[model samples]
Target: MGSVFCEGLTHAAMYARFRPQVPASLVNYILSFLQEKCKGPMNNAIDVGCGSGQSTRVLSSHFKNVVGFDISEAQVAEANKLEKLANVSYKVNRAEKLPCETQSVQLVNAGQACHWFDLSKFFIEADRVLVPGGVIALYGYQFPMPIWENKTEKLTKLFTDLYLDSLHGYIKKESLDVYYSNYRNLRFRIPFEDYVQIRNETLYAEHQATVADFVGYISSWSSFQNFQTQHGQEAAYDILNTFETKFMNELGVNTSSADTELTLRTNYFLQLGRKPTTTTKRGNSPVEKQTNLTH
Candidate 1:
């Protein structure tokens, strides 16, 4: 149930500090679909693999009670430490075995962390906990593209090379394979109704951060952490230092400070499915609604 990537306290803290929060538009997109088949008011929503409660906290605004689950104790502890709404709580638990009662949860969501789960077991658990018409939303963002005033294209290429080329060897292929395929490689079975696939390749979860902050975000990547573990801090930091220097140079910021501010444009994808209602027929074929929404 545990992921090797997110283990220690330092990593968990860094994850909480740097990972982007779930965008409100994406949340609304999920909820809109959930509300369509939902019987009554939105009640319980669970955020599985909820690292540091960033995604979990957002659900508090819509649900009566929102619970976040993660396999890492350090992550749950860091989530608990954060100031969240009274209705939101974090627990150390695995995705395959949810703690909720049968037919109780309205929505079961997994953010960037879904790729690490045993999807077959987790789907069964999601089916067990969700109400007949409840929704299961699996969503994640791709590597962030750096956006400056006018040099957006060149900066994006630089960022892409940093992620896909420089850190390629460090990436855990098994989990990232699912992620890199945008979860399309995952096979779904019966009892789940229609499948809604949304790929917003340009939908930006706009985040304002300094060059140091961006480096912090990059360092939070599991691949980067792996690199740090194997190569040691000095060697690993050399990569970030090079990135910082190049990024600052592109922006013409000669202050030699890592505090140069920039915007991060992250693309998102969502795979949504619904549990069959009482009158709905259980079928092997899933109806798919695919959309490429640009924002």
Candidate 2:
């Protein structure tokens, strides 16, 4: 099979495995942000790169009509199956070009999936579909929050080095910065504003997972899966085993029944931009609104 085909299969498998583990509270928080920012009932909303529709389900509560689009047909199918609301729908589509009518949507949102989109094209499409004063919200979260534990930190560093060394041309930090900059740049283009990062305070919930769960989450990463396929499963498993041993030793976990309590510290970006209005004559751009919250 072609490399592209193989990558697609790997991604599908990975998404299937991790779809259920996505925290419900996180989804509700994102929806709450949209509700508070957009103000009142959002008549129509679109979720780009919606995956298995966990986020899409949250969106359905706020909008009378909600449509979720993704590049993977398998994901779309899964999302459709999981959607319980009559107003929610799922389709297989790319972020760069949506099938919706121009200037028709009230809110356009990209959840954790924003990192995978082409920012330039996504913004253009967003601008096209949003009505005047409509809102565009892009957000994502980083997991294993503090990552302060010595073993976790070292394993993370090792994973970073492996990816960098294997994918010689890839720059991980620069890639992350793209999403950050994309939201930051919105201030110049539209009525851009954002929230400060907040640390996870509550011991919200805890779950235990085996080595397979770790591998499943890692495989969900397109870059890591591609790297594994190119380098071979033996090479990938070798690294996985090494990291597992280190992680277990540090946590005093038993290999026979290895399980780790996933403690997550989440930082999120709540970027909101308003579609330009005709009456809003050109003037010095308005100052951005920012709020910092902690619990």
Candidate 3:
């Protein structure tokens, strides 16, 4: 998890271009829960770890004001460049130290990016920033179930076994810890009363892509990028191409631009907690620490 944002323009650009939006159904699912439980105005939402503003932009349509925050200047810059919403803004801020007043936000969210935070610090900050009955949602999604047709699922299995699986060592161990428990079971300081467990859900996204898009999608992974940085780019992409070849050959195609429709059964793990209306010296209360890690 060192250099969580990862250096280089190419990495940031690839993330912005390839990371798919969290499926609308999932977004609506969260919004619906908040609307039902919130006791304050639905004025603003802070999208922490909102890399490339994909999740941030989604919130803008619902909340009157949406702000995206990330520690990377490059990520923040890229988000700003592609963003045009008048009420939406991007900031270079950490999840544990948001530049906001106490109880100023209606909702605080993390999209596939909370595993990186120091949980102790984050919970304190989340409590301090959210209004009474304000909701906090943390969620992450698994890799896509790459497919061209029914039988092609086997091709995806072969590809994962060969390429994606090889990058396991490059992935942050803390992320594995979170996944093993399912995102719902995170250790947090949110009091038991305010802890509202969201059911684990599997939402589907049927996306159209060329073979190159599929490759680019994998390239967006932090583990894949880390492998490229440590072991020359030529060596890393070579292995990727072999996996690509195996899939293309399965489909009886040889080009990277072949039209491929990928159906991703994204297993979304959502953990929701509400900020306590009665504060108990929130930030001063000591709690177990969380890893400053990321995907």
The best candidate in terms of lDDT: 1
Tell me the lDDT of candidate 2. Answer: 0.59
After superposition, candidate 3 runs with Cα above 4 Å error: 1-9, 188-194, 254-258, 277-295
TM-score to native of every candidate shown:
0.86, 0.69, 0.86
**Which parts of model 2 have CA positions greater than 4 angstroms off?**
1-10, 19-40, 146-212, 255-258, 277-295
lDDT tens string, model 1, 206-253?
888766767777789888889989998767778887876787778887
Please give me the total number of clashing residue pairs in predicted model 3.
1
On residues 188-278, what C-alpha lDDT tens digit does candidate 2 reach at each position? Answer: 1333333233223232324454544554565566566666777886665565566555555555655432344444344454455665543
Q: Least accurate stretch of 10 residues (summed lDDT) in model 1? A: 286-295
What is every candidate's alpha-carbon RMSD to the true fold? 6.4, 7.4, 5.1
Q: Local distance difference test, per candidate?
A: 0.76, 0.59, 0.72
Pick by TM-score: 1 or 2, better one: 1
Better of 2 and 3 by TM-score: 3
TM-score of the candidate numbered 2?
A: 0.69
